[model samples]
Target: MIDFDYLKREIKKEKVTSFLVYQKGNSIFEYYKNNKQLEKLHKINSCTKSVLSILVGIALEKKYLTSIHLPVYSFFTELFKEQMDSRKLDITIYHLLTMTDGLDFPEFGEWNSFAPMVYHPNIMKFVLERPILHPVGTHMNYNSGCSHILSAILQKVTNMKTEEFANKYLFKPLGIHEFYWYEDKMKINKGADGLVLKATDMIKIGQLILQQGVYANKRIVSEDWIKTSTAPYFKTYDSIGFYGMHWWVNKLDEKNDFNYENTYYFALGFGGQYIVILPKEEMVIVITSEIYENSLLPLKIIQKNILI
Candidate 1:
């Protein structure tokens, strides 16, 4: 059993503003700096990517989109036709989902601090025109632009905005009441980032995945989609871990004395939002924090205390 009291004390000691943990569809623990007031919706940042991944899975399960193997250019000819090089035409939806589009866009640092690319009028055109740094599917680069393109593609195929599609397929089905996604200048949701939800809603997402896309005995997303999305698609940074369709894959070993069964995956956001799901343990840990730095420390503690 996990020591909720000890975990709460440690989190408070570290000055974490807000934290929530769910285990097997129950709120196992919660902590907050200002417990008197209701928690406000905080910016989830790049955690929106993981939400987009789920939306993509739902779209596929519904046949709104054809398949992941379809070339990205096939759907968005207007954007990719003359702008993208011939070599880039081979890029597929799978590559975008795996963050292996070969584009030179990086999510970190001050690259676009001077000018926000998401607000730019010709954002897709600008992204399409960037020189290809490597062959498609050959490398894993954390590119928010790739996710943006996916949002556009989703809009094109479904004939509805990504937010609308998500609301219809995902949010409504999951009974998520309060949430919002930021829209680009063209009024498309910035699927690479800009999603906000309460910490409890975040936990529901993890629970859905832990149950393999089933909620309340209903198959919201196909089991196959869940398995495929959570499976390792490509290697990210050598130091961090493997990337699996917008989810992070972590391996556990008995040498580490972890109670987990060697494999666990999680959805990570820029600030300190995590939706960690351990299928074997039937555990789901959802954490929302204001601490912008070293959010993974709490996750490590959970692994050490609860899972191990």
Candidate 2:
């Protein structure tokens, strides 16, 4: 029961580059005003973290890493000096996934903010050298550093680049072959931002989550990880409901694009990139825009016009 006219109007009003709605394994609506945009790959900002989250699941499934609770420092012992904060020793993969790693990461933590190391010769030092800003697991700081550390862990454990791992375990299986990742000077996947994907590939991830780690009749990711990643494990400092792994979640506002009393969790990025999944409705919404805005406008359109 999508209001197509309403959707078109809103996309025009907001100048959204792409809007895709998928339900029950089908794309019900897709709109792009310009032909060039339709063919161009869009940058999905922080949503890269969520995609890494999926890779973690795949890594865990294949036993590249033992458990999420394992201490991250153990995997990268060379990164740490002989003397460091004892509390830092407590940091774990769970903390990284939840953005609770407690490094004093500021907004835009990845661009050029790291201390003495900078992103020049070694990006890993830039991330690993960060001082512990908060206690482990007490609060959420919305960190890209944490995700990068997880990426480092994946690479160290699997002995393969994160993109290679993803290509094997995630993208190839999902039938996604075309994409590029933002790499640091060290050629490591940024694992936080600068992932370019086609609109269809973006929604493919949404559909994968909606199907609980299954795609094309094959198990792509672990169901246990998917369920645990989507469950509201901890509340965010912002008004955004709970954050599970790298996903933002909130309760169903029945008045919104969802008529049923169900919850929705989405992978959001800067400048209005989103992959929102309304689990109860079997609906997956992909929105890409150039607004440099927050989450309100696209959310409103989905709530107001496309819920039922």
lDDT of 2 by residue, 1-308 (tens): 66798679878988589998888988788898688877688998878889999999999999988899998779878777642777778889999999888877775445432223334477667666678888998878777778778887888899999999998989999888899987777777878885899888998999999999999999999889998888777775445567889988777763454223567888888777889998888989999888674545776677678654
Q: How accurate locally, in lDDT, is each candidate?
A: 0.77, 0.81
Among all windows of ten consecutive residues in candidate 2, which has the lowest summed lDDT?
111-120
Q: How does each model score on TM-score?
A: 0.90, 0.90
- Estimate, for each residue in 42-123, the C-alpha lDDT of model 1 and write its tens digit: 5677778888988899989889887999998888787776863787798899999898888767555456311256657866
lDDT, candidate 2, equals 0.81
Q: List ranges where model 1 is wrong by over 4 Å.
A: 36-39, 109-116, 254-260
Candidate 1 TM-score over all chains jointly: 0.90
Flag clash pairs in model 2: 257-303, 257-307, 258-307
Q: What is the lDDT of residue 267 in candidate 2?
A: 89
